[model samples]
Target: MESLIDKDRIQVKFSAENQFAAIEMAAKPLWEQGYVDEGFLAAVMERERNFPTGLPTRVGVALPHTEAKYVIKEGISILTLDKPVLFAGMGNPKEKVLVEILFLLAIKNPAKQLGVLQTIITIIQNEMVLKKIKGAKDPKTIYNLINQFI
Candidate 1:
């Protein structure tokens, strides 16, 4: 299987006004590269609104994703924000977290979703990795760092 973390799919110091914009920015590469279907973005945005994926880790990370039907090929789109954006907390939607990173997931294969999420969660839990990602000036650095965990 091809690696899900493509260097080109990673963006560093990405600027977005809000979480929705951040999700759009992060997911764009996947959609453009045919990793996801045309309606994927809409589905992801809708899912995000209903069941927020923002987690309160050492550094907040948002996992915006939808059902498998929207994915053409499984892939992960990564974005390290220029500024943290507000997203409803995963555990409690009433609370908000300032998300510094966005992991936009496109999973065509349902069985692999849990494994993928767990790997990304491992990355999110490591402050050193999050710091490295935050300080990264280029996508190659982020890609390699994330590839290691994957």
Candidate 2:
């Protein structure tokens, strides 16, 4: 399995206007690389609206995704915003979260979702990993930090 921090899918932006804008902007590189389909951006936005993936922690993170078919490739793409973006809460409907790190995953295998989720969970559970990801200054640093998991 390859790490998600591929050159084509990484974006380093200071801020995003809103959640939809953030997702669309981050998904562009993947779309351009043919890792995602034409409808993937819309689908991911819709899925996020319907079923939020926001996880509240010391350092809040969001795992935005849709079905596997939307992805033409199997990898993870990471986007870190200097300012946080708002995403609806996963366990709570009324609550909203400020997500600093967005793990935009493109997995073609539905069966791998569980393992991917597990890996994400484990990584986030560690305060150090979360801190490292949050403190990473560049895409390559973030990529190197996450590659340790694989």
Compose the digit string of candidate 2's lDDT tens values, residues 86-149: 8888988568888887888888887887788888888888889888888877777776766788
* lDDT by residue for model 1 (34-138), tens: 999889999999999999999988788899999999888888899999899999999799989999989899987777888888888888889999989988999
Q: Highest lDDT: which candidate?
A: 1
Q: Ten-residue segment with the worst summed lDDT in candidate 2?
A: 1-10
lDDT of each: 0.89, 0.80
TM-scores for all candidates: the values are 0.96, 0.91
